[model samples]
Each structure stands twice: as C-alpha cells, then as structure tokens.
Target: MFRNGYKMKPIIATLAGLMLIVALACAGESATPTSKPTNTPAPVATATSAPAATVPAGATATEVPVPAEGPELTSMETYMQSSGYMPEWGEPKTGGIFKWRVSRNNSNFSPNMSGTTHGLFNMPRYGSLIRFDPWVGFTSIIPDLAKSWAWNDDMTTLTFQLYEGVKFQNIPEVPESYNGGKVRGDEFTCEDVGPSAERHVRPPKWETTLKKGQRSLWHLTGVTCPDGPLGYTAEVHFEVPLGKTMSALAQGLMVMLDKDWLEWYNTEHPAGMTKGTNEAYHLGMGTGPYIPGEFKSDIVGEHRRNPDYHRDGLPLADGIDVVILKDFTTAFTALATGQIHVMGRGSWSMTPAQVAQAQRDFPDRITVHPNAHLFGYGVGFNVGRAPYDNPKVRQAVQLAMDRDEWLLLRDAGELPGGMKMLALVSGTPWSYSVEELEQMRGIRDKLTPGGQEDVAEANALLDEVFGEGNRELEISCMAAGVEYVEDCLLFADMMKKNLGIKVVMESVEPAVGTDRSKTGAYEMNSGAVAASTDFGDPDDYLLPKISTRYNANSSAVLRNLEALKVNEPELMLWLEDTIDKQSRELDFVKRHAMVRELENKIYYDLALYIPFGQRMAFPGTGPAVKGYRLFDLSLYSNWSIWERVWLDE
Candidate 1:
C-alpha cells in the first residue's frame, strides 16, 4: 500500500466553534441568536429546470406533478447557502431513477420505532429541526425544518422560528376519522414539535418497545409550542449545555413525526404493534422530499419524489429504487453491472482494495469518492457469565487481541495503516496521534517484540484466573449479517492461539442475539460491530455508547453493562454520573483532559469493550450521479446530502 498522497480529512472540532464559550456566557448574561432566516438559495443548477425522469417506454411518471408557484420554493432558498455544492458538478438535470442498495431491510417506516436502516428509507421522508451542513465539515449547524434559532442567557432555554407553510405529503392514505377530519397534508407548525419531542424521549410503553427514539433525544427536558397548535415558534429547554444539545439536533436524527398521526396511531394500536409486521406499519406522512412507496423485507424499497415538497430544485431524481443486497460480493457484482447507481453508504460499505480494483476495471462506468469513517467493531463480553465475571479474564481477551489482523481482515487482506488507528481525529485530547498509535503495545505489528510480550502477559493472566489448562468459553456469534460472523470467528481464533484457551462458537439470529445480550445469556461475541455516531462530539459518541448504556444498532460492549442495572445498581449509577461530568465541564482545556482520562478509565481500563479500529471509506457511485459531494466526516450524517444530487446521463 503505497501513498498516492491522499491526506486524512481534517478533524472536526468536538464542540463546533465558540459554542463552549457561548454556552458558558449564557450562564451569566443572555446570548444572541445563532442564526436568522434569510434568502440564500444554492447557486448550483438553479438555472436549469429538471425534465421529467425517463421511465419505461410506455410507463409514465406515476404521480401527478404539483407545479411550483413562482420559480422555486421560497422556503428552500433560505438555507441552501449553508450547505456546500461543487462547481464541477455543473448544472443539475432532473428526472431519472436513482437506484441504490441497502444491506438489509428496515424494521418499520417509523424512525421512532423502526430498526436502524435510516439512510435508505426513513430519512428521505422525514427531517429534523436543525442539521449539519451537507458537503462541508460537521462544525456548522444549518436549518432544516427550522428557519432560525436562538439561545437565551439561561443555558437550558432555547427558541426556534420554523419555516411557514411547510406542508406534509398529501397522500390519500389518511382517513378523516384519524385526525378529527383534518387532512394529513395540512401545514406543519410549532405545536407539532411538542408531541414529536414527547414521543422521541418519553414514548408511551417505556419498558416494552421503541427505545431508539429515547436514545436519540435524551438531553431534552421539555419542548413546547408557546402559541396554539399552528404557531411557528417553539420553546425548548434541555438539561445539558450546548455540546449535548447541538449534537442531538444537528444530525437530522430526530425525524419530526406528525402530531395528528401520533394521536391516530395511539388510538389504533394501544399497546404499540410489533415492529413493522402489520399492513399499516408501512404508511408514512412527512415534510421531506420523498414519499414512501412499495417495500419487501430484505428485498427492496421504493421512494417516490414528493411533487409538493417545499425544498426547491431538490431531489433532482424522480425517485430512488433501493435494492437490499446482504452480501458484499453480491453488492460489488451489482455495482459492476448497472443494477445500482451507488452503494447505500460510504462507511464500512467497501474496502480500499475493492475501490482500487473498480477504478482499474470500470473507470469509465464507476466513480468512487473518498470519505472519512468514524465507526468501529469489536467483541462484547457478558460479565454476568462465569469466567467473564472475573476482571482478569476480560483483560486477558483484549491483551491477547491481534489488532493488526482485525484491520487487515476489514481492509481485504491489505493493511491500510495510519487511517483511523482505533480513534477519530487522532492527536486531539480524545485519542492518540497516528504516529503514537502505530508504536503502542496492542496496536503495533504483532511480529514485533512488544506485541509478542502483550500476548505472553495475557496467557499468564488467564492461567492465574482459571488455574492453568482448565479454561474454555463459548461465544454466541450473532448472525446479524455475514461480517458479524467473520469478526467473531477472527476473535475466537485469536484468543485460542494467543492465550491457549478452548473456544467454541454458536450461531444465533439478530433478534435472539439481542435477547441474549439483554439477559446476559451469552459469554462473548461481536455485539458492537458498527459502533458509531453522527458527529465528532465526545459526549455524542461517549455517552450513548460506552459511558452509560448502548442498545441501538450497536449493542453494548461493556462487561457487567446489562447486569449493572439490576445487580450492582449503586456502582453503575455512580460510574455513569462520573462519566457525564465531562459534558457539563465548560473549560475547553479542562474538558479535553477530562474526556481523555474518562475514556481511558471508563472504556479501556476494565477491558470490558474492545475496539476493532477505524477505516477510510470510499462510496462507489456511477459517473451519472452528479452534484454528490464527499462529506462523510461522520458515519451517518452525510445521508441527507442526497437532496442536492442530480443525474447527468
């Protein structure tokens, strides 16, 4: 792997510009508004009108077009300047089917209750109040559904002015009985924010189902529409300071659900229906650029462009045809053919070797764009189980890990060192620099003496714990996807060879694996295979992930995590409280030091969670997909950029 001289992407500021100062200042005196509504449409493709997307010779555009009033959407122009657009992409042309892929099916259409396959399905139809600027660094917070926002002198209080006349999709799916005879296509307003926020953090069935919503918006203490239901002003109060609040808002993670729709849903399914199994589960009503259409689990999903969408000159393609391909080899084959225009996401979608091979073989057809990756994977042990209950056994597993081999396996047998190095934005207080990480004990080349020394020490620890030649463990290898099995097998082999222990494996479905983790029924496995977040904020990644409790796309990887809730209540509560102290710490220098120390002590010291390291991702797309920018600083943040992408050919 020779350097073609590709530089690593710049580190995104953890707090995102003078936000730390602004938040602290608010404690003393009132602060000014951060952004205001303005007329600023994007320059790219404003001159050209998108022609009707070409369909089959006889097949016409399925939906009727709702012509724009003037030239473009008034609401759309106000925030376009915040996002970056490429000059080389030239004039945008519209009206073509944007074919894509997702590795698996979404559990449901609701972002609140659905399983996390957000990029492909849920997000295209819904939006958040604020968002990170598309095609730029993650530092800037831009308006989405909101026109502008301000922070009061009190750190907890915030206010928002929303875009007026924003209307939900006007589909005939909603019946008059559902919302007191009001059509579902009515205007979206500030009053809707209250109910949407309530469902997000405090859903009705607290213990039974739908917890991902709570994880996404845990900071907010209250959200309200000061005026009646149709008012455009929203008042919000969060328990934390600026860092935690902005991270939750800027990622488009909270897709504002329709208030009337929620009332209807509660009336119909009192106990909350099982995730997406029923016929009514597929329905969607949103203010975003697309409308949900046909879907078949683990097969395909269709999103038709919303003709009445408020965003002007957006969603250049007529629709997106999403095909689910679970296997990487199969996905590559589809990419080589004309089956799909691009891979589903840039992060962890393909290896560097695959991208290079595609360039050499299909340069004329495929164009791969570079992206920064923040996601990593590794083994998570259930500490409530036997030998794993002993801290020595957990420490031995991480010490014996051949980290370089894990990277090599992920990189398609080639070591792309110095890319992610088990950390995001290395050299900062959050993690070590690339140079420093390369020489460390666990991360350095295993053939080196230092690496071998770690393995020897690991063996000694295991012997002391299990009384020499009497140690064995069975890992429940989660069958969530093919990669999960591969990572689990590699880890089992490493532990057996390095520490000389007997390892056995059992395969279980994703649903079964989640249950096993919750009840501490499994010894160890790849539970946190894609541990990731939307931004560079330390609190955003640290709190929901390793610090407190993890239960979304990536399961918890810490020892005693599940057991701590019931068995060691006080210890867990004290440790969680201590970890969150960094969030409230205002001083930049002090907070940086606090973040590093907490990470070392809370995450690495106990060896409860082992990281699989990071990677630089390349999203493979067709040359026809124009105006698409390389804005992947965060693993899941850039999916919203699809709004600006248009087709040329």
Candidate 2:
C-alpha cells in the first residue's frame, strides 16, 4: 500500500556545484532515467566543508543514482558533509540583495484578488497567521499579528488572539517611512485586526472598487470583531462548513492593513486606489518583512527589508529586487548567464533543448525543483455546443488522440497513469485507481481500435453527430500567439486526420478564453487551471471546473446545467458522506468514480492541457545561498522562511 503519511525531509547538503535537469516531464510520474553523466566536476565554492547528521535506522536514505560511471561518485549528502554549508539548528545568514527575474509584473497586490499575479506577491512579503515551511516540510502557524487562535466544537468558528507589537509600515498620522523613520503610536492593536476582518465580511461598499481599481469584497458573509485581551479575539462565522478555512485564512486572507494608512491612501490617490489601477505602487503599509520601495509598471518592482519588521529575526536578505521579464527566452538566458540569481514561473517556457543545454552549460550554477501539487494544462470542450453535445463525439475525440504520442510531440517527458484525463491529480491523495482507470480505457477501446490514428472511427462519430455533410465544425481556440495554442492546433489536426472532422480554429485574447469558457460562448476553450497550494480535497479539483455555482456564468455551455443544478445538493451530500465514511484511499476511488460519471455525461470533455511529460523548472543558486531549498518554487514552497536564509559570502 502507498503510504499517505510520507513527509519530505529538509534538504541538508550543499554541493560545490550541481547539475540540474529541468525538463517538462509528464505530471505525477517519476521521470525515466536519461543517459547523462553524473560525476561532473562540482562548481568551485568559497565554503568547502559539509555538516554531519545521523541518518535514523530504518529511515529511507535513497541516494539519487548517477546514470553513467565516469568519475568516482560523491553523494550530495557527503558533499554537504565535506562542505561547511549544512544547516545547523539556528537561523540562517540573512543579508544580501537577491535579484530574481519574474515573467510578469503583478496586476494587483491585494490578497483578496483571485488572479495569479496578486496571489504570488501577497504570500511571501505578507505574514500569514499560519505558513508552510518547505525546509522542514510542515505547516506552522506563527505569532505575527495574531498571537493565538482556538477552534469551536464544530470547527466552524475560530477566535484569534492578536499580538500588540505588530504595526503596519506607513500610517499617515504617524509619518514613519519604512526606512529609518519612527512612528509615534502604540503597537498595532485589536482596533486594526477587528475592523479589517469585519470589512472583509461586510465591506462598507460591497460593490465598490479598491484603490487599485479592483472589485470589493462582496462574497464574504460575516466577521465579528474582538472586544477585550480578548481585544484581539475576533470571531469569524462561515455560511457553510469548511475544513480548509483556517488554512486559507492563515495562507493570506487574514493579512492585516493599518486603518490610518488605508484611509490616507484612499484620500491621497482617489483615482489610483480603485481595483484595476496601479495605485498599490504608491501605497505600501503591510506589516510584512519587505516594504515596497519602487515600482516600474511591467518592468520591475523593488522591495527593501523592513527595519521594523515584526518577526523577531527574519527576512535575512537586505533587499529583494524583482525584475519582470515577460518573455521566457529572455528570462532563461538571464538565468543561464548568471544575470539573475533566481527565476520564478519558468516551467511553461522550458523546451527539451533548453533543458539539455542548461544541464550542459551551467550545470553547477542552477538547481531545479519540481512542485508537488497538480498544475494542469488541458483543453476544455463546451458541452452545451451541438457536435460536442453528443457523448459519442466526445468519447471519439478522447479515443482518437494517443496521450503518450501527444506527450512526445509536445516534448513533455513522463506523466502519472490516467494523466490523459485528469492531468494534475494523477498520483496524489486524489488519484484514481488502476482498476477504475482500466475501466475508462475499456470505454475508449470500444470506440476506437488501439485508441490511435482512428480516422474512420472519428469520422463516423462526427458524421453521427453533425450528419453527413461538408459542413465543418467550428472549434474556437486561442491564437498561436498564446503559449499553449500549439497544443490546441495539435488536437485540431489529430481530429481532422482521424475523424475527418475539419475544425475551424478561432483565436482570441487569452482572457477571452477564460470569458468564453465561463460564459459558454465558445464551443471549446483550450485553457489551463492551476491548483491553489492549500488544495487537498477532490472538491478543489472538481468544484471550480464543474460545480453549479462556479459554472453558472458558463451555463450556456452546460446542456444539462438545470438537471445538474437540481442534483447538486444530492451530489454534495454524497461527497460529504464519502469523505466521512471511508479512508482517503477509498475516498479517492469513490471521487474518481463520481467524476467519471460526470465525464460520461459530457458536461465537458477533457483534453490534454498540461500535456503530460513536461516538467516544471525552478532555478536557484546552490546551498551556499542561505535559506535556499530545492522546494522553494512558490509561496507554498520552501521560501516562506525568508528570515532564516543568510549569505555565506
């Protein structure tokens, strides 16, 4: 049986130099070993000795295998032991300006915004009540603004005790800049925390726009502020029972802002303060470790370490400079040439050739870390449309394309089994069983022979749905100008060759894909869905993609929306009962069966979005860079302990 309780250990070794392979491999499955030399010379480093740590008996100590025998092999553990860079039981070195090349500038910085741009910036600089430590690989709730929290009997209401020393960076009346200025005020109190929570629950202007021109908080239900020592104890009530609410709140939602600064920023920059405007550039008042210093729209954003940062001793870096390189090629070049120390979100841009070249050229300078969560990129067919409205047509399309072939064509390396349908959730707690997957394959086999190059089968299904005519099907997809547009064209070409179905490609803005998919405007929208870090439940996989509430806007594409809406209550109840009664292993099996039923109904036919075989890449310096870990890919990744990292140089 696969152990669900497996936790990752902190990477403790520092290689003088290391070669990292950053291929776009298939999701969920381990990569096939390539014929590469393992005993390459280590990069020269200032520190040459490693630390010693005992490996517990019976604990797994699997060494990464070297492919070809060339030079004597030195284990990464032994390398760290020989080098004095191993992490000791104390805070890491913390002072240096680390420059990172980012692909895009943030559109908004508010934690409440649902976009990826906002989500990325909000998590690192801002302090969460609880945070994930990638080094130790555990979730820890820290005493930042909130000192302590307790749960109710039903796990519904969570009351938090606020810390007194916490203070927002720039309140107008106090006039203390983030640099060396001093603010004449008591440490942040319940007055700040209470109102902030209350506002999220019931904003004064429910539909009002923010200073950044973004939408207001209208989705929240209620927030009750604290009264006494207890002044910090605020009660939050939910509309429905949510198990991950605390985690979500701790992740970023509960980030506190100073009331004075909020009011001043709004007054000083009335027009700029709206949700979509670039007003956040002028306003930086969070109690985070870093204070926003400079902002160049779509070019760069600089943040200086906060001198008054509430964390006892954190944010080891002197400053963080984020340079936005919208082009992947430019970012990759920067990483290869040592123009930047780190690169964020470079996975989608790396090709097979680039991965090989990086390993060859800058073998010792870079380290690549794969994120554990599912990041799916697939095609979504609008089921409300005519041709796809037919279940047989959808099934025929699934049968026509070989997932393995598509992976090879796409240059994606390896993927977990059953990844063709559910690209991201292939091997986790939510992965489907092999038996159930085989049953799905049987359904596909009945429609096509060998499930590859079945032109007649595809044509037969297309003709059955649209009738025997020269009338072509219009499958609207994003233009090739977008990143994954080629994948859409690949799907189109396969369908035309095998099924004799001529699909007219419609290209539009990337946002149009999201709009069309949500509104069911297009017959099919080839897009991708990235899983949030806190996601563990299968509902996280299914709800936004297919739930009635989420799909209401795209109701046009859902032929059976009305029927599904009626059955939603029962489905939700079934999901809850399944969760309560079975173990996680059985729960995944049951969930897989349930989602398979939905897939059969053809609400949306799954297409290869992630293009299995592509591996995500996170490039960073070796262990000499303090606070650096292989898993520091995102906010949820190991970089959360920024204060713990220090420069050895």
lDDT (CA) for every model shown? 0.59, 0.44
Model 2: weakest 10-residue lDDT segment is 1-10
lDDT of 2: 0.44
Candidate 2 lDDT by residue in tens digits, 157-248: 55666555565665233355323323323256555554555544444463242211111122235557657422655665654444334334
Candidate 1 on 1-649: residue-level lDDT in tens? 1011000011113223433433322221122322331233111122111111211010111211111223332322432333365567676677888877777766655554332354566678777787765665454556677766776655566787777777877756654446473547767887678877877778776224556456656768887777766898898888766444665666665677677877876676554334444244345567888886676666667778888776665677888777677766466555655556777474435555555445444555556665545555677667677666666777777777887787666552122421433423332234555576667656666788998888877778878977776666544544444547877788778877887666666677877777777656777767444345455556545656555443432344453565544555664675567556766655445655666666555444456666666555666777677766655444456546666677787
On the 0 to 100 scale, the lDDT of residue 269 in model 2 is 43
Candidate maximizing lDDT:
1
What lDDT score is found at residue 444 in candidate 1? 68
| True lDDT of residue 314, candidate 1 | 66
Backbone clash count, each prediction separately:
2, 51
